[model samples]
Target: MNKSSLKVVAIGGGTGLSTMLRGIKKYTSDITAIVTVSDNGGGSGILREEMNMVPPGDIRNCLVALANTEPIMKQLLQYRFKEGTLKGQNFGNLFLAALADLSGNFEKAVQVTSNVLAITGKVLPVTLENVQLYATFEDDTCVEGETQIVDYSKAHHKMITNIRLEPRNPKPAEAVIEAIEEAEMILLGPGSLYTSIVPNLLIDEVAQAIRTSRAQKIYIANMMSQPGETTGFTVENHIEELEKYIGVGTIDTVIVNNENIPEEYLKKYMEDGAHMLSFDAQHPIWKLIKRIEAPLVRINHEKEYIRHNQEKLAEYIFDDF
Candidate 1:
């Protein structure tokens, strides 16, 4: 197959999905990012409460990643205000809110934004309902709202045992199932295990479509454990957690990072109680699925951060595909 023309559907939200989109867009214009909208935190929550629209933060990130615009335009989209009542709010989220008002709906605003930016492919919210995310800790204590879940988990040092969407089984967004049906490849995540990735699957129709699609389903492992959310989780632990919702035998492959992180950066992550997610060769999941481990880490000295090497990661994914 001509990989450049391959139809790809990527699932998840937050920086990871967009980060993957950055690399995948470099290879294929036929990309569709299915982002989560259950975010009730940060600038997104405030805007969502005020605007009564789907949170635009994740959607905006995906649009910027796939955008074919100038660097300045991208910067403008990502720029956040430092002062005023709107301090801490993202310009892109506000842009979407304004577009929502003009377009009469959040979905239409996303579509219009895509056209204006001339972005590659499409970005679809998994569901249209104003969903709430809830997580039950291993101690069986539960918390409502994405923000509270993270804050309480960190404050108490509790592991999340379960997470579900309020008003479960909300309808999937239009064309979402169609995109999955038409896709040649479907990528699950490299994002926050509980909030970014799982909520999408809670929508019955979307998860069902993914299960029945002919597309090769790949779950990209996060570069490291989410410090508070998925602390101490291994690659297999993530897969098992995912299977709790999607069922077994759904994932055909798992792609993980095997590269060594620089000690200085590793120490920084360690300070935050996060660690690189490594694999156990003897894990039984290996018997049922294909595993690809490669050097996928890239250091950003300017930002003093480490992230997936987008181009390298996409090359490896397509190579496996």
Candidate 2:
């Protein structure tokens, strides 16, 4: 397929989806990001409570990632207030909130903001309904809200047994379904397994559409395990959990980082109960899915974190897969 003609649909939330977009946009403008709207923390939670709208933080990040606007404009949107009543709130989230109010809909607001930023691709929320993410721990205790669940899991050392939306079986946005149907490739993950990725699949129609779509489904494995989310998770473990929600054989390919991270950075991450996810060639799941291992890792010395090398990752997808 011609690189420019490839229609890619990425699903997930937080920095992972956005980071992937920054690279993918260089090859094709036909991109659609289906973001998770179940965030209930920080600036997003505050905006959701006050404005009675879907969380815009993830949407804002995706827009900025795919944006072709000037550097100053991008910085302006990402700027966060350090003091006053708006302290810790991002300007982009506020901009989306204001646009939602002006347009009388959150999706329309995203479209308007995308146009304003001259974003290469579109970003759509998985569902339009105001939904709450709930998790049931292994201890039989149930928690409401994304932030609370993570905090409880970390503090109590309990694994999440099940996760679902409050208004269960939410109907996905029509645009999200359309995008999945038309996509030539569908990518998931490199984000929080439960909160950022699984929540989107919990939407019945969205999962159904994904399962039935003709696109090549790919799951980008996380470089490092999340503290409370995927602690001690292996590459196959991640795939198993994903299939438990989306159904068996739903994923066609799995991308994992083979490059080793330095001991110093690994030590820092280990202190926080995180570890690099290892890939086992003999894992049974390999029989059902294709594994693409490469040097997809990049370490940020200043921030002291590990992430996928965007350009290398995009190139791998375009040229290899």
Candidate 3:
């Protein structure tokens, strides 16, 4: 069978989802990336309030990952203004914003951008409705907006107890449901658990579609915990949280990173209260679902960063499961 003929629907936001898309696109061209739009921080946030449009940062990264454009074009898309009021703003995001304005519709702008880039697959925001992300910490104090959730949790040193989309039930894009139904395999995560992954599932229609789809549901576990969001999380804790949103048995497999991090490298993350995900094989969750443990981390010495080894991850997702 032509590998590119396989249908895949990846749901999440941030670099995690975009990084995975980079590798997964090598395996299949029929991918539908359902990205989160609740980010209310940094460049995306600034544009969201000012433009009255879905934040374009996450969407731009996904589009770039799947793009078959020239290296110069890629560089151009990633360029950031070093000074002036746009100091931290990403050019790709601004480009997307301009497209959205010209088209008078965000999705249409993305579609036009996709065509211009000659991307391998489609990208869809999880929802079209204007929505805000809200979170209540274990202390019962709630905050609105995605960035506020992190900042509040950090300031008060509290674990998040729950999160939901503002306005309750934001309707997902029509393509979201169609992609889920056509998907041969549906993948979630590899992003921030609450703000990135869960926010997408918070859409009632999107969650229900995943629950009812016949596709195999898999989760790509994060390599390290987020400082404020998942300070002490273990692999099981992550899965438990996911189950709360999507229901037990909705996830059939989890891809955990068992690769050891160098103590020197681990020190940097540890300083920020993040560490490699700890997993217990004896846990009962294993009896209910399969776990694929491998060296998923790909380190960049020059850049001093770590990301999933895209090719290896994609290979395992196909060969193992």
Summarize candidate 1's per-residue lDDT along 60-98 as a digit string, tens digits: 999999999888888988999999998999999999999
Give one digit per residue, the lDDT tens place, for model 2 in 136-182: 98889999999998888677767888999979989898689999999
Q: lDDT scores for all predictions?
A: 0.90, 0.90, 0.89
Q: Evaluate residue 185 in candidate 2 and report its C-alpha lDDT on the 0 to 100 scale.
A: 94
Cand. 1 Cα-lDDT: 0.90
Specify the highest-TM-score model's number.
2
Q: Mark the 10 consecutive residues where model 2 has the least summed lDDT.
A: 312-321
Candidates sorted on lDDT, descending: 2, 1, 3
Runs in model 2 lying further than 4 Å from the true structure: none
- Residue pairs with backbone overlap in model 1: none
Candidate 1 Cα misplacement greater than 4 A, ranges: none
What lDDT does candidate 3 reach at residue 297?
83
Clashes of 1: 0
Clashes of each: 0, 0, 0
TM-score of candidate 3 to 2 decimals: 0.97
Per-candidate Cα RMSD to the true structure, in Å, reads: 1.2, 1.0, 1.2
